[model samples]
Target chain A: MTKVIAGASMSLDGFIAGPDETGFEHLFRWLGAGDVEVPTANPGHTLRMSAVDAEYLRDQWDNTGAIVVGRRLFDLTGGWGGAHPIGRPVVVVTHEAPTGWEDTPFTFVTDGVTSAIERAKALAGDRWVGVNGGTMARQCLEAGLLDTIGVDLVPVVFGKGVPLFGELANAPVLLGAPEVVVGSGVTHLRYDVLR
Target chain B: MTKVIAGASMSLDGFIAGPDETGFEHLFRWLGAGDVEVPTANPGHTLRMSAVDAEYLRDQWDNTGAIVVGRRLFDLTGGWGGAHPIGRPVVVVTHEAPTGWEDTPFTFVTDGVTSAIERAKALAGDRWVGVNGGTMARQCLEAGLLDTIGVDLVPVVFGKGVPLFGELANAPVLLGAPEVVVGSGVTHLRYDVLR
Candidate 1:
């Protein structure tokens, strides 16, 4: 069975980002000093993350095969900003084609969720597929195409903004009890898809 | 009035660190981007806080004269290990001094929350005091010591863990509507201390 994992960070109040995505430091602080280390530009503030935490994250990425993302995610992700780190095949599900990165050879399809996922599975072969955006991830969930849903629960709460499963009127998506994994107050939860 | 701003990245479920506190990456992914550049041990993943965001954060810090944290926060924070970036006076409210950073110049107080805060304020000399840590933050909240509460709500939820506020008998804390700031999902909320 081809497994699709919806892995993303969320705030304490059930929001993915704030109104304009401000106060993003809360997200980085959740990463602790270890997940990603950036020297404070202020030079007056110090931060650090546990090394043991970093190794754990690298392992999670190893379980994936291909990645599927939406236009919003594709745009915000800085287009790998001239570099592709994951190296896995990427399938972007979008209504419009992105400029510049067209040379990178990523598959662009407007065939909606199912078709893009099918192509991603084909490219992924025997590996797990990573569902990369909240809305697109919800679409896959609505279609009952997801194999696994991974939610990393962060500790802070944004009163409002985009939600993980933004306003879908589709059929109910049953989820299993999430198995919890803790790192830097970011809880990694996994729910297996049945039916 | 010295105003200290305390902030951190959090998950949707209110978890500071997931199960092992080492496996989750979504918070790191959402944060530490170009806006909040987080430099990773991996040269490839190093990031820097965007000037806009950095300036915003710095502006928040500028209002404070001292910082107050609890025992757990101090311990979990790796004692600002190897890099105590903030030169401002730091007051750690703990039952006992934590090991390792004993040599660090920060004041380690083995006293109650109120006393520690007062001492910090005295040292601050007209500067505002910033308090971090769930227990101490709550303590200040309960004692009606805090003038304002700033919440940088990250979007995610953990079913359980150290709560933002522990059990306080029927007393309620009132928060004002939050203001949208930066990024895709971060929001800043304000709360007036209404005992």
Candidate 2:
């Protein structure tokens, strides 16, 4: 069975990004905090992380076959400047599919999150459907389609910013105690969404 | 040297309480998730927690000699109804000291967080000063008096609630990677505040 997981680097105060879309340096500092190097799907864009995090990321990328992202993040990152760093097919949830991209690994879903996730799952096979962006994660969570929450918990306080799952409609969403793995400057927490 | 530490049982999304002041049951479920019984200052109030958390709580209580709180929480818990659960004296930071509560473990400080903590430290001697409530913690952190951030992270998402440090004035407060302790229903993270 393919599981849908929401993944992001969050601050100790639970923000994925600081106000004005800042604080990315602190959030993603762990990506370069150590000596071990892990190559990304993008050419010449390898990530250097702690050995523990490198192994963790390697395992995650190995198991995550496809990714589901919101149009905001897709546009913000300019569609990851081409291929996503995770080397997985991306199923974008947008009202309208963007043009000028033909033979890429991007599938633009002109529907809602549910349809986008279904398409991603079909592409994922027995692997996982990785979800990105707070809006996308919240939609998947509220729809009960999110299986896991993968937070690379950084040690910083962004008083206000983009939350991992922003303004959840069905809140008090119970989750299992996270499987914790402490890295150099980040603690990886994998929480299972309870039914 | 006495350390100033802020402690709270926070939701995964950094909330100390849920919307409408709800979600305490989920936040504190770990206090009764196991069989190890830890007695509080109140004769009849004992907490049953997993062995690891019980030890952690015992050590924290043993090390914490004085607790500082905000007036809102002091009135909310009705002054803990008596002595604090950790059997420590409480120094409440308030605009005005309340009357009718003399010779008790509670001391009302009408000055500020710095004065309150100073008084608490004088009362604490060599032991640590524990700061409670988001407002109190935020003040201490901003004043550069906070030494550690002790977060008992519960596995629940409270979409809207009182944050651990609500609306931080000095954000991007970087912290050291936390010392992680995974309990049955909680994960105790001890993060040192970087000066």
Candidate 3:
């Protein structure tokens, strides 16, 4: 079975992004905080992190066969310049698919999260379907389709900003004790969502 | 020199309490989740937890010589039924000091968190002074008076609730990588405030 996982690097105060989309430097400081290099799909772009974090990141990248993300993120990075860092097929959840970007690794779904997840699962097969944070993650979790939650918890307080899973419709969402991986500037916690 | 630390049992989503002040059972579940016995100030009150948690709790309680809390918490538990769990002097920060509580182990500070912390530090001598969550923690952090942050992070997400430190005035407050202690159902993280 293809596991559906939602993942994000969050501040200690539970914000993925600080107010007005600020504080990315603090949230993602671990990306360049160490000596071990973890390269993404983009040529010449690599993350220098601690050996512990490098290993964890490599494993996550290797296991993720496909991705489901919301439209906002798609536009934010200009669709990762057509290649996601995960180096996997991308399924984007959007109302209207963007123009002139066909015959590539990206698949835009016009319907809903359920359909997008279903398509991504088919694309992922036996590996895993990685969901981006914010809207995409919230929809998947609320719909009971998310299997695990991976939080790269950084040691910074953002006070107020975009939350991990914004305004969860059904919550008190309990999770099992996480498989913890302590890195240089981040503590990676992978928790299974309880049924 | 006495260290000032603010601590709380927080959800993974950064809530010190769930919506409507609910979900205490989940927040405090780790206290009763294991076999090792950890005794409180009250003779008859004992917590059962894994050896890991018991040792952590013991170290915390033993090192904390005094506590500072907001008036809200003082009234919430009726001043912990006259005896705090940590077996230390309690300083309550309020607008008006309540009457008839003069001879107890509690002190009321009418000025602010600064005065309350000063009193707690005096009472603590060479030991650590602990500050409670929410308003008290926020004030301490904003004023650059808190030295460390200790979070007993539980595996739960409350969609909306009282945050760990509500709306920090000066944010993007970076911290050192935490000293992580993994327990049965909780992860105790102690982080030093970066200058």
Candidate 4:
């Protein structure tokens, strides 16, 4: 069975993005400092993720067969230059798909987050479906679609920005005991959703 | 030398307190689960903090010679019933000292955070001074008086409450690599403040 997992590098203040939303680079700086190659929207250079951080990042990608992301993230990164960074099938949850990307490799689900996850699960087959972007992950969590949550807590704190878990209409979700891994520049915490 | 160290148990959302400003119990629940005795504002039942959590809590108290807290926290807890919880001297920072408490064990410093810390350092002798409460810790961090910061990151998240670090007049303070200890219910992260 395909399991849905959500992962992101967040600041100590729980902000996945800075005020301008262009600060993921700072929040995920640890990934670049490592020795494993990480695919990014940027084409100029390749970032390295090493040691425990490398293992964690590689596991997240290797286990993931598909991804679900938000429309804003897609738009901000220019639809990953028409190709998802992970080279996996991506189901983007958006109210409206951007024009001219109809033929793109990414699948934009306009119905809702559940619909997007459904498409992702179908694409994932027996593998895991990973969800990114704060809003999409929150929606998956609220809908009880996420099986696991991986948070790479960075040391820095953004005074203000997009919070990871904002006002969710659903009740507080209980999480199982977390797997804690202290990396070079980030602490990786993985928790199973107790549904 | 008496170092000024700030410590607090904060939620994943960086909230030290809940909406009603009385949620430290939930954040610091692991302390009660451990085997060490924690002196709380309430003198009812004794809470034990043992095992790794107990060691951590005991070390914090053993190394602390004095404490610095905000007036609000002091007032809310009725000045720790005229005696500091750790049986050490406490410097309470506020605009004015509360009436009729001038003869209490806790010293109310109206000058400023630096003044309060100075008094705490004198009382601390060669031991470290701890700063508690959100406002006082922030002030110490902003004033470059905090030498270290220990945060026990709780798994729970409060939707809204007092944030650990809100707006600060100074630039972002850089923290050295943290010493991470994963406990039963909380992850203790201790970082050296790079001044």
Clashes of each: 62, 0, 0, 10
lDDT per residue as tens, model 2, A18-39: 9999999999999998899999
Candidate 4 local lDDT, B104-150, one digit each (tens):
66888899999999999999999999999878888888888988888
Best first by DockQ, ranked: 3, 2, 4, 1
State the displacement of the C-alpha of residue A54, model 3, in Å, after optimal TM-score superposition.
Answer: 0.5
For each candidate, give its TM-score against the true structure.
0.48, 0.99, 0.99, 0.91
Model 2, range B1-195, lDDT digits (tens) per residue? 899999999998999999989999999999998999999999999999999999999999999989999999999999988889999999998898889899999999997889999999999999999999988999999889999999999999988899999777788899987989988999999999997
- Candidate 4 lDDT, tens digit per residue, A78-177? 8777777677888888887777877666988889998888898889998999999888878887888888888888877566778887655653454666
- In candidate 1, stretches whose alpha carbon ends up further than 4 angstroms from where it belongs are A35-49, A99-105, B1-195
Report per-candidate DockQ: 0.04, 0.87, 0.88, 0.43
- To one decimal place, how large is model 4's interface RMSD in Å? 2.1
User: What DockQ does candidate 2 score?
Assistant: 0.87
Off by over 4 Å in 3: none
- Candidate 4: give the TM-score of chain A: 0.90
- What tens digits encode model 1's per-residue C-alpha lDDT throughout A1-195? 668887777654444665676545654555564645433323444345555445455566566678888877777866555433456767889897767666673778887989989998888777788887678877887787887877765555454455666644442333443555556545465766656
Query: Candidate 2: where are CA atoms >4 Å away?
Result: none
TM-score of 3: 0.99
Binned by DockQ into CAPRI classes (incorrect, acceptable, medium, high), candidate 3 is high
Q: Tell me, by DockQ, which candidate is best.
A: 3
